[model samples]
Target: MPSEVVVEKQKLKNPPLDLRYLGDRALRQPAKRVAKVDQELRLLAKEMLQTMYTADGIGLAAPQVAVQKQVIVIDCEPDNPANPPLILVNPVIKQLSSQLCVMQEGCLSIPGVYLDVVRPQVAEISYKDENGRPRTLKANELLARCIQHEIDHLNGVLFVDRVENKIALNAELSKHGFSAKAVKPIA
Candidate 1:
């Protein structure tokens, strides 16, 4: 089982956050790195976790909530209350495996749009924990993919932008009433 937060789904309260959707200008803006991880940042992480749970998402980034800050909250095992969640501030991917895996990825911002995106099979990241302590995490499988996805948000990147299938990507975006031109594909 991947790392997760021990959150009671029933007791979770949805935070009042306006989630930026696909084609939203705010979603395209890069998130600024958080220099200080204080109580307020911790509180934001809690709220982000709550919002992610409410939206049935595994991971979320500050930019998704319209806050241009480099903060991310992720829980790979949301169904398990005993599992702990991860909160990363100013997360930087220090290493990525050469091996790649294609996984169907979805985003809270681009709801209802899922596409297969190729990403590194493993990732090692260094970041500040919720308590402002330096921490490092090495993850594989779904957890690894989720981390990469959220980190992309911090850099103003989206999963759709990583999709290689142009026809499928455009079709999916169009089906969801989103403009394909908004996607800034990574070469």
Candidate 2:
């Protein structure tokens, strides 16, 4: 079963969470595993979804809001009201596909800097739902990408760090007024 916690899929003028930007120290620290899932955590998850929607983002991580918990909210199809957003707590990557794909990726933290990143086409993940029920998800395509991207936030990685093309990465970051030095390449 999917997450039962639901929020209005609409943008709020004053979102509850204040998103931390790309170079923020909060975004650089690895998130702590959720010690316990409770009403307080669920409320934070709701605010996370609200902030993600308000920023027109498909995915969001707790660290993006300076929350040190292992939580993420994802709604790949925000336009579809029937689709409920996913709320993941203490998420862990169980597996990743060997097949890689390159797609244009953007981040709410990075704002206007959209760059190409190479990531696995499929991912198997395990997480706790808003109800604290353990769940497994095998996601592919956009959902897979979104999951991996948000999970990276848990590990203190930005999509820019996974970008292979240094030239393009530098240009994109510079154009967006972000220093290239802030990018710590994965490999």
Candidate 3:
């Protein structure tokens, strides 16, 4: 079946949406669950995909664009036109592997700040497709990490907030011109 919303996977000079940065209050606010799947929501997903591709990001949450809706778009293979992007609405993480892995993570919202963050190696999530159909996904490795990271945005969390190395985190944030105070650490 074709994707509910489709756009050429290419970077445009001006994307439809503007991204909120690390310290922006909009990015720090939790997103609201989507009440219904309709043309407007689908359009948002399409615009988000375009913005994500333009920003060269593998995943993006609605909150990152200050939309304040529980929506996410992911495409690990932005270089592959054959691979369809994943648009998730009101996504919920149902399971996470006990096994943890540390991987380098970066975000468009945080710009140049990249750091190693530990997360479950595998994850299972349930969410609605752009067409309002319910679906479940079991993913591992980078896909799992992407899912977790994007979902965290729906909850007003950023990848930097999960960085365990305080020294590295502080240094990177400072170098990137973002305040360490903006990061709300998780546990």
Candidate 4:
């Protein structure tokens, strides 16, 4: 006779984030609801920070968590203890330049897949900080790219959508042993 077996399921410390699909239904238009930087958003920010840290990610957008609001959390200064993680609400990329740079990028949504993507090297963004005070920031380098990437997600654009060359994207996907069968166009 086999010994009696018992198993217990452990709850996830941080629930997995939801990645929105690109479509009319998924396209989150500019929200007029005006998200308040209240306790819920704060808690969400905290969870996102925890999730990002767990995943070793530099930034995360609200859309990645199934929140259809313009929110983002970033901790690009990972080495700096003095600089805490930032939470932006109703973020808007107010200004962008023509200059572009390409960087190999990966997404937490589509795990284990990386591809080169071209984005503006710098951008001026205006958003309400965690305190709900309007703030303007001029970001460059990796920070700029991250902000652009997250903001794009709020507007229903994926990094794959910004791939300058599909062949290159597909090649990279193939190299990683992932299929590019479900590639969606930026709607």
Candidate 5:
């Protein structure tokens, strides 16, 4: 059996998983590391990838789907069918670059809102593949940022929390009909 399953680029008859929004309690809770990579877990990853593609998102965390598991699916190039998505289980950040870059980031949970968030330029992460095989990846630029953002979701952290410019943050949130209070800023 293949270690990973690539969800075909086809819309399912049913709607995607209901994503937990910023103010939702489920989004605040930290996700638990997956204990076993069974058939069920693999199925969840497949479904997550499908949900992400359907929502036009590059990355998604298990908590976003109210799963409470440390699973994340990322696909930087969704338009290219040849490029497969990644399924990370029990991911751990091993190294981070000292350099920081600021980029506009958006989340499916907080739709219609975008904010500039600063993050490390590079990251090395160790994780398990969909087959539960150990794997490590060194990511840079957009991929690094995406992985960090999704990892934050596993830790109950939102990209809004990393937004330093409160004025811009509040404006975007307000414009998107989201409450500014929903953001829990980090020091």
Candidate 6:
């Protein structure tokens, strides 16, 4: 089947999952397989992009759609310029630098939740493109942070897990309509 057809079928058969806005358990479940880029995944990707755009987000993950798949769509295009959208399938971070950068991060799953999470300032990632071709990306700034944050969802990690200061996170969480206890770091 054509990728577009498959994505469309999936959209009809399986609706996108509503993100869980509270609780750590929902945020920790690993995503399932993305069999292929059928019509369903493609439609889901479009809807996700719409959602992200509506919410003023830079990136989104499949798990946020309530789908257990290693897929992420990103458009860090500031001012909604001429840049094309990015669709990553089964993405993996190949390299993480020791240089730490702290930036305020948020999640679609954990709605309104924002916290300063310290992570590598840059990352090298490999994944399948929209056409099922392998591709690699070296990212920085908001793009880098957004990718790392979304990829973490694919691995059952949340921004709160990487938060360096609890008090600041708690404050931010309140503003975002989230509970601070909704996330806890793995030991």
Give the number of the best model, judged by lDDT: 3
Question: Model 5 compared with the native: what TM-score?
Answer: 0.96
Better of 4 and 5 by TM-score: 5
- CA shift of 110, model 2, Å: 0.3
Cα RMSDs, all models: 2.9, 1.1, 0.7, 10.0, 1.2, 4.7
Worst ten in a row by lDDT for model 2: 1-10
Best by TM-score: 3
User: Model 6, clash count?
Assistant: 13
| lDDT against the true structure, each candidate | 0.88, 0.93, 0.95, 0.70, 0.92, 0.73
In model 3, the worst 10-residue window by lDDT is 1-10
> Could you estimate the TM-score for every candidate?
0.93, 0.97, 0.98, 0.79, 0.96, 0.82
Error of 4 at 101 (Å): 1.4
User: Tens-digit lDDT track for model 2 on 1-187?
Assistant: 6465689989999999999997899999999999899989999999999999999999999999999889999999999999889999999999999999999999999999998888999999999999999999999999999999999999999999999999999898899899998888897
Q: Report the lDDT tens digits of candidate 3 across residue range 19-76.
A: 9998899988899999999999999999999999999999999999999999999999
| lDDT for position 182 in model 2 | 87
lDDT tens string, model 1, 1-187? 3223334554245455768898888888899989887868877887788788888899999999999999999889888877788889999999999999999999999889999999999999999888878889999999999999999999899999899999999999999998998899999
Candidate ranking (TM-score, best to worst): 3, 2, 5, 1, 6, 4
Give the lDDT of residue 124 in candidate 3.
98
Of 4 and 6, the candidate ahead on TM-score is 6
Give the candidates in order of lDDT, highest first. Answer: 3, 2, 5, 1, 6, 4
Q: Give a tens-digit lDDT track for model 4, residues 70-173.
A: 77888786556556776788888899889998888877665666778878899999998766778899999888998988887777667877677788778876
**Model 4 lDDT, residue 55, Cα:** 66
After TM-score superposition, what is the CA distance of residue 154 in candidate 1 from its true location, in Å? 0.3
Which pairs, if any, clash in model 4? none
Scored by lDDT, model 6 comes in at: 0.73
